[model samples]
Target: MANSFSGADMSLRTDKAVQRGPALQFTVDDQLVDAFSGESVAAALFAVGRRELRQSPRDSAPRGMFCMMGSCQECLVWVGQRQVPACQVPVAAGLAVQTLSFRRQHLD
Candidate 1:
């Protein structure tokens, strides 16, 4: 069952006016996929079967979407900044995404 937010259940996003028309199309890690224009960067990633978009160098733990509301650090990333939540970010055309593995973060 979907998690309930507030007293009411989490209704489908289709009711939102922003959900009109087809969602913006794009590729994540070179894989073509579709995501709602209202969806954040992380949502687009998950739709493409990418659960671990990055890893912590210290512990090397897999990191991706944790708090769908951008509360946890698990979904943290760098879009030019450290620890940016993927779920809270919106998908945009020409978004150049680079995976930051433990090795990649420290190499540079």
Candidate 2:
């Protein structure tokens, strides 16, 4: 089978050409991750290799960011009591994020 995704490195690049805001820290699934200002939660997670954002509700299959836009809804995560798309929310210091599967596994 041919490689479905053939392209340059799409992961977050930290070259000097790219300007970023001050460094900040946030928690994903209770694990602290480093992020830069003005970065979306999905970007931050992807940078650190936390790609699996949530599991499929019907089959429990792994899911990650697809469109990187809010319309896809593949990167949904929990922030406090509210469940929001990771691609839509900007990373804030001390912010707590949890995967749906994380909560489900712990709560069960």
Predicted candidate 1 versus true structure: per-residue lDDT over 1-108, tens digit per residue:
221121122133335555343456554444444555666777666654567877776887777777799788677655544546666667675553445653265546
lDDT of each: 0.57, 0.80
- What's the CA error at residue 86 for candidate 2, in Å? 0.2
The alpha-carbon deviation from the true structure for residue 77 of candidate 1, after best TM-score superposition, in angstroms, is 2.3
lDDT of 2 by residue, 34-60 (tens): 778899999877876667988787998
Candidate number achieving the greatest TM-score relative to the actual structure = 2
The TM-score of predicted model 1 comes to 0.60
Off by over 4 Å in 2: 1-12
TM-score of every candidate: 0.60, 0.84
